[model samples]
Target: MRFTAPVDGEPVGAAITAEPLEDHFGAHSALESALMAAFDNGRNPIRSVCAESIDQNGGKGVVLHSGLFRVDGMEPDRGITA
Candidate 1:
Protein backbone atom coordinates (compact mmCIF):
# COMPACT_ATOMS: atom_id res chain seq x y z
CA MET A 1 0.00 0.00 0.00
CA ARG A 2 1.00 3.62 -0.56
CA PHE A 3 1.68 5.81 2.48
CA THR A 4 1.88 9.54 2.95
CA ALA A 5 3.22 11.58 5.83
CA PRO A 6 1.31 14.20 7.75
CA VAL A 7 1.38 17.79 6.57
CA ASP A 8 4.09 18.38 9.10
CA GLY A 9 6.18 15.77 7.25
CA GLU A 10 6.61 13.52 10.22
CA PRO A 11 7.31 9.90 9.40
CA VAL A 12 4.31 7.61 9.62
CA GLY A 13 3.67 4.03 8.68
CA ALA A 14 0.50 2.30 7.55
CA ALA A 15 -0.84 -1.09 6.68
CA ILE A 16 -3.72 -2.09 4.42
CA THR A 17 -5.39 -5.40 3.79
CA ALA A 18 -8.44 -6.88 2.11
CA GLU A 19 -10.38 -10.05 2.84
CA PRO A 20 -13.85 -11.56 2.82
CA LEU A 21 -15.84 -11.96 6.00
CA GLU A 22 -19.04 -13.73 6.94
CA ASP A 23 -20.62 -10.50 8.16
CA HIS A 24 -19.96 -7.06 9.54
CA PHE A 25 -18.83 -8.54 12.81
CA GLY A 26 -16.21 -10.60 11.08
CA ALA A 27 -15.16 -7.63 9.07
CA HIS A 28 -14.69 -5.72 12.28
CA SER A 29 -12.39 -8.42 13.51
CA ALA A 30 -10.31 -8.28 10.37
CA LEU A 31 -10.07 -4.52 10.56
CA GLU A 32 -9.08 -4.63 14.18
CA SER A 33 -6.38 -7.12 13.43
CA ALA A 34 -4.97 -4.88 10.78
CA LEU A 35 -5.09 -1.87 13.04
CA MET A 36 -3.34 -3.70 15.82
CA ALA A 37 -0.62 -4.78 13.50
CA ALA A 38 -0.20 -1.28 12.23
CA PHE A 39 0.11 0.24 15.67
CA ASP A 40 2.16 -2.53 17.15
CA ASN A 41 4.71 -2.41 14.36
CA GLY A 42 3.88 0.69 12.38
CA ARG A 43 6.09 3.79 12.40
CA ASN A 44 3.28 6.10 13.41
CA PRO A 45 3.28 7.19 17.04
CA ILE A 46 0.48 6.97 19.56
CA ARG A 47 -2.58 9.23 19.04
CA SER A 48 -1.76 9.54 15.39
CA VAL A 49 -4.66 9.47 12.98
CA CYS A 50 -5.10 6.13 11.30
CA ALA A 51 -7.63 4.81 8.86
CA GLU A 52 -9.16 1.48 7.91
CA SER A 53 -11.43 0.27 5.14
CA ILE A 54 -13.90 -2.56 5.45
CA ASP A 55 -15.58 -4.45 2.65
CA GLN A 56 -18.95 -6.05 3.12
CA ASN A 57 -19.26 -9.75 2.63
CA GLY A 58 -19.94 -11.21 -0.83
CA GLY A 59 -18.72 -8.17 -2.70
CA LYS A 60 -21.54 -5.96 -1.47
CA GLY A 61 -19.52 -2.74 -1.00
CA VAL A 62 -16.87 -1.03 1.06
CA VAL A 63 -16.97 1.53 3.86
CA LEU A 64 -14.07 3.97 3.74
CA HIS A 65 -13.24 6.73 6.21
CA SER A 66 -10.67 7.96 8.70
CA GLY A 67 -11.48 8.18 12.41
CA LEU A 68 -9.20 5.72 14.13
CA PHE A 69 -6.73 7.12 16.63
CA ARG A 70 -3.87 5.02 17.90
CA VAL A 71 -3.72 4.49 21.63
CA ASP A 72 -2.21 1.89 23.87
CA GLY A 73 -4.48 -0.73 25.43
CA MET A 74 -7.68 0.65 24.00
CA GLU A 75 -10.00 0.27 21.04
CA PRO A 76 -10.10 2.70 18.17
CA ASP A 77 -13.06 4.97 17.66
CA ARG A 78 -15.79 3.82 15.26
CA GLY A 79 -15.63 6.51 12.66
CA ILE A 80 -17.85 7.05 9.65
CA THR A 81 -18.43 3.73 7.94
CA ALA A 82 -20.47 2.94 4.90
Candidate 2:
Protein backbone atom coordinates (compact mmCIF):
# COMPACT_ATOMS: atom_id res chain seq x y z
CA MET A 1 0.00 0.00 0.00
CA ARG A 2 1.13 3.55 -0.71
CA PHE A 3 1.49 6.20 2.00
CA THR A 4 -0.10 9.61 2.02
CA ALA A 5 0.12 12.86 3.97
CA PRO A 6 -2.36 13.09 6.83
CA VAL A 7 -2.67 16.81 6.31
CA ASP A 8 -4.65 18.39 3.49
CA GLY A 9 -3.53 20.70 0.63
CA GLU A 10 0.03 19.41 0.80
CA PRO A 11 1.05 16.92 -1.86
CA VAL A 12 0.62 13.28 -0.96
CA GLY A 13 3.71 11.40 0.19
CA ALA A 14 5.65 14.67 0.40
CA ALA A 15 8.60 14.21 2.81
CA ILE A 16 10.94 16.70 4.48
CA THR A 17 14.67 16.59 5.15
CA ALA A 18 17.46 18.76 6.61
CA GLU A 19 21.24 19.03 6.23
CA PRO A 20 21.72 17.11 9.50
CA LEU A 21 19.95 14.13 11.00
CA GLU A 22 16.25 14.60 11.57
CA ASP A 23 16.50 14.26 15.33
CA HIS A 24 15.01 16.28 18.18
CA PHE A 25 17.94 18.67 18.20
CA GLY A 26 17.70 19.50 14.48
CA ALA A 27 13.91 19.73 14.49
CA HIS A 28 13.67 21.91 17.59
CA SER A 29 16.37 24.20 16.31
CA ALA A 30 14.27 24.96 13.20
CA LEU A 31 11.34 26.13 15.34
CA GLU A 32 13.27 28.28 17.83
CA SER A 33 14.57 30.42 14.99
CA ALA A 34 11.08 31.03 13.67
CA LEU A 35 9.76 32.23 17.01
CA MET A 36 12.75 34.49 17.51
CA ALA A 37 12.00 36.12 14.16
CA ALA A 38 8.37 36.64 15.14
CA PHE A 39 9.46 38.42 18.29
CA ASP A 40 12.42 40.29 16.82
CA ASN A 41 10.71 41.75 13.75
CA GLY A 42 7.30 41.47 15.40
CA ARG A 43 5.94 39.64 12.35
CA ASN A 44 5.29 35.92 12.61
CA PRO A 45 7.19 34.44 9.74
CA ILE A 46 5.60 31.98 7.36
CA ARG A 47 7.90 29.00 7.71
CA SER A 48 7.03 26.46 4.99
CA VAL A 49 9.72 23.89 5.56
CA CYS A 50 7.89 20.63 6.21
CA ALA A 51 10.15 17.62 6.13
CA GLU A 52 10.10 13.86 6.76
CA SER A 53 12.03 10.65 6.11
CA ILE A 54 11.70 6.88 5.70
CA ASP A 55 13.52 3.68 6.65
CA GLN A 56 14.73 0.68 4.65
CA ASN A 57 11.25 -0.77 4.19
CA GLY A 58 9.81 2.72 3.83
CA GLY A 59 7.62 1.84 6.80
CA LYS A 60 9.31 3.68 9.61
CA GLY A 61 8.57 7.40 9.22
CA VAL A 62 9.69 10.69 10.79
CA VAL A 63 8.00 13.99 10.05
CA LEU A 64 9.33 17.53 10.67
CA HIS A 65 6.62 20.22 10.76
CA SER A 66 8.21 23.50 11.66
CA GLY A 67 10.01 23.39 15.02
CA LEU A 68 12.74 25.52 16.61
CA PHE A 69 14.26 26.65 13.31
CA ARG A 70 18.04 27.12 13.06
CA VAL A 71 18.11 28.39 9.50
CA ASP A 72 19.03 31.77 8.11
CA GLY A 73 16.84 34.95 7.74
CA MET A 74 16.18 35.03 11.48
CA GLU A 75 19.33 36.12 13.24
CA PRO A 76 18.50 35.48 16.86
CA ASP A 77 19.47 38.14 19.41
CA ARG A 78 20.53 36.11 22.40
CA GLY A 79 21.58 39.37 24.06
CA ILE A 80 17.91 40.37 24.29
CA THR A 81 14.64 38.56 25.03
CA ALA A 82 11.05 38.92 23.77
Candidate 3:
Protein backbone atom coordinates (compact mmCIF):
# COMPACT_ATOMS: atom_id res chain seq x y z
CA MET A 1 0.00 0.00 0.00
CA ARG A 2 1.10 3.50 -0.79
CA PHE A 3 -0.06 6.65 0.88
CA THR A 4 0.51 10.24 -0.07
CA ALA A 5 1.20 13.03 2.31
CA PRO A 6 -1.97 15.00 2.75
CA VAL A 7 -0.28 18.37 2.56
CA ASP A 8 2.37 17.96 -0.13
CA GLY A 9 0.96 15.12 -2.24
CA GLU A 10 4.27 13.28 -1.97
CA PRO A 11 4.44 9.71 -0.85
CA VAL A 12 4.69 9.64 2.92
CA GLY A 13 4.75 5.93 3.50
CA ALA A 14 4.26 2.52 1.93
CA ALA A 15 3.54 -1.00 3.07
CA ILE A 16 5.65 -3.78 1.71
CA THR A 17 6.37 -7.37 2.58
CA ALA A 18 7.80 -10.58 1.26
CA GLU A 19 6.31 -14.01 1.13
CA PRO A 20 7.32 -16.23 4.04
CA LEU A 21 9.89 -18.79 3.03
CA GLU A 22 10.70 -21.96 4.88
CA ASP A 23 14.42 -21.44 4.52
CA HIS A 24 14.24 -18.02 6.25
CA PHE A 25 17.75 -17.22 5.21
CA GLY A 26 18.54 -13.74 3.93
CA ALA A 27 14.94 -12.69 4.31
CA HIS A 28 15.86 -9.67 6.39
CA SER A 29 18.49 -8.54 3.93
CA ALA A 30 16.09 -9.04 1.05
CA LEU A 31 13.44 -6.96 2.71
CA GLU A 32 15.91 -4.25 3.47
CA SER A 33 17.04 -4.25 -0.14
CA ALA A 34 13.49 -3.91 -1.33
CA LEU A 35 13.01 -0.96 0.99
CA MET A 36 16.15 0.72 -0.27
CA ALA A 37 15.00 0.22 -3.82
CA ALA A 38 11.73 1.89 -3.05
CA PHE A 39 13.48 4.86 -1.55
CA ASP A 40 16.08 5.06 -4.27
CA ASN A 41 13.74 4.70 -7.22
CA GLY A 42 13.64 8.51 -7.55
CA ARG A 43 9.98 8.52 -8.45
CA ASN A 44 7.91 9.21 -5.37
CA PRO A 45 9.38 11.23 -2.56
CA ILE A 46 8.62 8.84 0.22
CA ARG A 47 9.07 10.23 3.70
CA SER A 48 8.45 7.04 5.61
CA VAL A 49 7.37 3.40 5.37
CA CYS A 50 5.23 1.12 7.45
CA ALA A 51 4.68 -2.58 8.12
CA GLU A 52 2.60 -4.70 10.46
CA SER A 53 2.99 -7.95 12.31
CA ILE A 54 1.66 -9.67 15.36
CA ASP A 55 2.96 -8.32 18.66
CA GLN A 56 4.49 -11.67 19.45
CA ASN A 57 6.72 -11.53 16.37
CA GLY A 58 9.89 -10.29 18.02
CA GLY A 59 12.09 -11.02 15.03
CA LYS A 60 9.93 -9.06 12.64
CA GLY A 61 9.72 -6.24 15.14
CA VAL A 62 13.47 -6.15 15.37
CA VAL A 63 13.86 -6.06 11.61
CA LEU A 64 11.21 -3.41 11.15
CA HIS A 65 12.77 -1.15 13.71
CA SER A 66 16.35 -2.04 12.96
CA GLY A 67 17.25 0.02 9.93
CA LEU A 68 14.50 2.43 8.90
CA PHE A 69 11.48 1.92 11.09
CA ARG A 70 10.43 2.89 14.60
CA VAL A 71 7.52 2.24 16.85
CA ASP A 72 4.94 4.87 15.98
CA GLY A 73 1.74 3.73 17.60
CA MET A 74 -0.17 0.60 18.28
CA GLU A 75 -3.80 -0.18 17.73
CA PRO A 76 -4.57 -2.43 20.61
CA ASP A 77 -6.78 -5.35 19.71
CA ARG A 78 -6.53 -4.41 16.09
CA GLY A 79 -8.54 -6.87 14.00
CA ILE A 80 -9.47 -8.66 17.17
CA THR A 81 -12.24 -8.60 19.73
CA ALA A 82 -12.60 -9.34 23.41
lDDT of candidate 3 at residue 25, scale 0 to 100: 17
> Which stretches in model 1 have alpha-carbon errors above 4 Å?
20-74, 78-82
Residues 1-82 of candidate 1 have per-residue lDDT tens digits of 2344332344444333333121211334546665445434533322333322211122222222222232332224334366
lDDT per residue for candidate 3 within 1-82, as digits (tens), equals: 2333332333333333332111111233456565445444522212222323322342132222232332334332234567
Off by over 4 Å in 3: 1-4, 8-14, 18-29, 45-82
Ranking by lDDT: 2, 1, 3
Give model 3's TM-score versus the native structure: 0.19
- lDDT winner between candidates 2 and 3: 2
Structure candidate 3, residue pairs in collision = none
Candidate 1 clashes: the total is 0
Best by TM-score: 1
Q: Tell me each candidate's TM-score.
A: 0.22, 0.19, 0.19
By TM-score, how accurate is candidate 1? 0.22
**Model 2, position 46: C-alpha lDDT score:** 19
